[model samples]
Target: MAKRIVIEHCSGCDKHSWGTKHDEAKYSSLAMNIASDIEGEASVRNIKLEVEINPPLDRKRFVPKKSESLQHVYFDKEKKKDIRYPRLGAFEIHYVEGTSVAKVLFSKIEAHRFPSRHDVTSALERIGLYSPAKDEEEGRYMDGDDTHRSSSERSSHNEDFTAVRMDFLTKYVSPLGYEGEEEVKKMTVGPPRAPTPEPEPEPEPEAKPDEKAEEKAEEKAEEKA
Candidate 1:
């Protein structure tokens, strides 16, 4: 049970030629809070916050491979759960100061003793790491088979190696439709908290008129008479 979130459209950026992109929305809000002072007095205060929301990723064009073509489902040994995925191969690469090391896993590795660099690259492409247009620009093409540019020419374009495997797991291979998963926690955002009320200060005693001095003056005048 999540609280219903609300968003208001932003009009301030309409004048810019490159307005808000299709992938994102912009908003402006003037949020205020009731704050308390040291003497327990309440006052209105202004607060500033920035929030960004990413809609769900689209997978409309995603076509799962055939059962026979898919590799062994990824298994989490610590959690003792099998992650069913359609891709045949998966890999991870680590870069350190212009040097890189690749770790790949292929369930059906009958053709070779160990995975080669080309094999790892092909796997990476399947997991959405390599762009075909970019490859073509670099004198590389993917035919029906696994023939592509040399690893030396292509490796330089890939800056973040860890993102490839992470995208493969979370964006593509991640499971949908939580079946046997734990219940989702509830979130509720209620109204702002009220501040403590401080009592007003007591009024000072009013000054009394100089009645004693006037009486003394009257007695002196009577004694003179």
Candidate 2:
């Protein structure tokens, strides 16, 4: 199956502080590292980094402007101070085998740890891009929990939360990877079986005329005798 990895930039960062040297370097490094990791993966067929040059305004929060330029303005407090919006700086990993796509959105705290190649690989592993068992080990190491737990148990506890986040993001963001509807299998119905035929009635036997004639002749002969 083919894999596609998308590294998305923060729209708020681009709109507000794109020209700033610090912001430029931050996003650039993030994009470069993600692209490198995706390209390094043999399973990845396509790698793309999409920046929101013209992000939509549907979710824009209107706040009173501090300056007198306007009474109210669209405000993104999270992205105003170089922090990514809750949904921004996300990675969308798609697999051709399944309809559902895996999504990862890095918090401000997490983004700081993503500069290294190891962190990039670890990020992919967390989003289920690599071996699941290996990912579990890495998760344990990262969490600093040495207790040995069964795969199912760990997955139920850890992976289940990831699944819930995936569900929430997919429902809210509804990324391009998940736009198409899943193909539904069609079921065929056969014609009903023909009913059984009924049996025919038996015909009645015809009486013999010779037996009547013999009886008459015998009666006449007895009368003459």
Candidate 3:
């Protein structure tokens, strides 16, 4: 059935809505019609409709000031500066919204060790990115008397981390660039199952004495008598 409703304009966002900014009468009427439509559609589809009004933002990329809940602060020793990064969990929570990549990444990741965002970040630090501090002691040392760290020491540390990142990217991520639909289908399906063991053969029973033959000989003897 056709339904008519007015779309009200908002001064703050310059957006039209059937929600908060709308006239109270229009808002109520709109809510009823929308709810009715959703209920009918949900019944037809055998699914429930959850309508959220003015849902809170899960993550915000930029803010007037820094908040721990919003971003992560990391110090970059080489640059002699602090870097701001999205908290991995918050980043993924934002990234997964309205994206096909979520399913692809999730399905692929399910077969691997990176279940939690922390695990994924750890994996990335080990093989995806070159983190400044390898351990707590080195990090503290770098913040203090880093001048004592020799040129060779810095070079060796960077080289090792860079080698790990490059090797993993080259050996694994780069090759994935060539993956087509079939390859992706296989990858997303999950790890292969182990082979099933064959069933053992049943043993044959031992032969029994010929009781039928003995009965027949006795019958023949009785008949002759």
Best by lDDT: 2
The superposed Cα distance between candidate 3 and the true structure at residue 42, in angstroms, equals 45
TM-score of each: 0.17, 0.30, 0.19
| TM-score leader | 2
C-alpha RMSD of each candidate structure in angstroms: 25.1, 19.5, 23.1
Return the lDDT, model 3, position 78.
Answer: 56
lDDT of each: 0.31, 0.40, 0.34
lDDT of 3 by residue, 1-225 (tens): 222111111122112233523233322333344334334433433443333221222234322236644234445555655544322111111112232212122222234211222223343334422243533333311211232454445433322222223333333333334234234334434456788989898888988979999999999999999
> Which candidate, 2 or 3, has the higher lDDT?
2
Compare candidates 1 and 3 on TM-score and give the better one.
3
Task: Give candidate 1's error at residue 39 in angstroms.
Answer: 60
lDDT score, candidate 1: 0.31
Clash pairs of candidate 1? none
Instruction: Give the runs in model 3 whose Cα sits over 4 Å from its true position.
Output: 1-115, 118-130, 133-201, 212-225
